[model samples]
Target: MCRTTLTLGLTGLALLHAGPAATWLPVVRRRLPGLAGAGDADHVALTFDDGPDPRSTPRFLAELDRLGCRATFFVVGETLARHPDLGRRTVAEGHEVAVHGWRHRNALLTRPGRVTGEIARAADLVAAVTGAEPVWYRPPYGVLSAETLTAARRRGLRPVLWTTWGRDWTRSADPDSVLATLAPGLRGGATVLLHDCDHTSAPGAWRSALGALPGLVARCRELGLRVGPLAEHGVS
Candidate 1:
């Protein structure tokens, strides 16, 4: 009976930790606009994850500069620690740097206290490198657990998930494919997810997202939408 009780308790804990992950569902995201990163009707929030990589991130920076647009780069803590110059450059380039956790591991699968500590550590690293406190936190793979939410709150970071993604991490992804995947949801008030590096994806897959930048920005302008970072997105 003791073993049975212990098993039940663990299951309950897992459920509680994973329940908020339901927000990943399209319907749930549509209903919870704020959590889904919905913002101003005339603006679109451009967010990139798993980055500050030396291999591919600089190319993304150059592309954004060419387009005259800025985006939020959700960087991994450990990666940023290794490339503090990249982090500094990101900020200096008129882009916003946000937390993508200390590592890219999902919060639900991380051991207790690990996710919490990492969130704080990552936020601190961003502040240390950029000299500005990051205002947003996006969990790796968009999974948010109970502890993840608590940690974010304690750090004064607001959790945000994207409304649409380019699926640019796939091995088959390319510029046109990335644009096509994101086309349906490209609208004002939509948060579009792209990746700046392939740290957790098919090697060199970031090219798809990089190649799509110009077209994406052009398409948004055609729709009379403004492309910028989440700070300008007016999330409320």
Candidate 2:
């Protein structure tokens, strides 16, 4: 009986970790409304997570610059400490900079108080450096819990998740594959998730996302979809 109960409990917990499960989980869906798609009409929000990498980030910045597009970079606090300049450049370049967390931690595995602290510190650090308070927060790996959700709301931060992601964190991913994954989700009013660094991903996986971005931007223009930060999605 003990083993059966444990097994069932684990199964439910695993289900909650699923990114797609946000649709079925009311507690998450209510507090995290951006997961399914755009909050506004006519534009799609482009957001990158786990970044501020000096190596890979500059290239992404350049590409967006060339295309006259802007994205939100949800930076990890720990990495930001190591590369404050990259974080600053993100802000300088017209992209929105938001907090991912103090570290890339799973909220479900962390205590509620600790989860709050993680976001608080990250938000403070980001604001201190950028002179702008991040209005949005995205948990690491897109995983969330009731504790994290409440903590985010308490800090005056809105929790957001993506409607479409390129799965650019894997070594197996490339520009074509990334574009393929994003194609189906490419529609007006979608939140697109990609990565700018590989600090927590396969080495050099960030390149896949970087390579696919121009095409993504072009396609958006072709479809008459404007690509910009979450602010355009009315996240703030």
Highest lDDT among the candidates is held by which one?
Answer: 1
TM-score of each: 0.90, 0.87
lDDT tens readout by residue for model 2, 1-236: 22332232234455433233333334333444554435666788999998888889999999999989998999999899888888888898899999899988666677658988889889988998888899888877566566666777788888777778888878899999999999998888778889998887789999999999889999999998899999877642
Kindly give the number of clashing pairs for every candidate. Answer: 0, 0
Stretches of candidate 2 exceeding 4 Å from the true structure: 1-37
Supply the global lDDT for candidate 1: 0.86
Report the lDDT of model 2 for residue 21: 32
Question: Looking at model 2, which ten-residue stretch has the lowest summed lDDT?
Answer: 1-10
Across 7-39, the per-residue lDDT of candidate 1 in tens digits comes to 322343434332223333364365567777899
